[model samples]
Target: MTILLFGVTKDIIGSSTLSMPSSSEFGSKRSKTVKELKEYLGKMYPELKKLSSLAVAVNNSYANDDTIIDNFDEIALIPPVSGG
Candidate 1:
């Protein structure tokens, strides 16, 4: 799976995009839902857990934690924005 990162997320992850193996093998660590994705990322990059808020979008639409995900889905991480 591929995830697009924006704003602070991009900074934290040190890249604009991230890739994960698209496999559903018994021992594969692929995320199956939005919530799992968050947990997976948080574990890999603990700094992500420090953010005040984080949002996820699937195929350009905001998705909830229960939202199902697959390797073919387009995912994005949106970080909080502060403005004057």
Candidate 2:
């Protein structure tokens, strides 16, 4: 699955695209969800753990981690923004 990282989240992971394990089995398959992906990101980029209330979006629609995602899908975590 292709994860679309935005703002600080993108900086945490360094690169945009990521390929982490989704299952326990060896090279079983890829998994996409708010929770699963969180774990993946936490490992790939531990900096995310410090943030709170990360907004998960699927195909531009705001969604939860439970939402099923596809390979061509676009997922982004919208952290809070500040305006002066």
> lDDT of each structure?
0.88, 0.68
Cα deviation at 70, candidate 1, in Å, is 0.3
- Candidate 2 lands at a TM-score of 0.71
lDDT of 2 by residue, 47-77 (tens): 8888876788888999877886655677777
Per-residue lDDT for 1-84 in model 1, tens only?
889999999999899999887552311554478888898899889999999999999999999999988888899999999999
Best model number under lDDT: 1
Q: What are the per-model numbers of colliding residue pairs?
A: 0, 1
How many residue-pair clashes does candidate 1 contain? Answer: 0
- Residue 26's lDDT within candidate 1 is 17
Give the lDDT of residue 42 in candidate 2.
Answer: 72
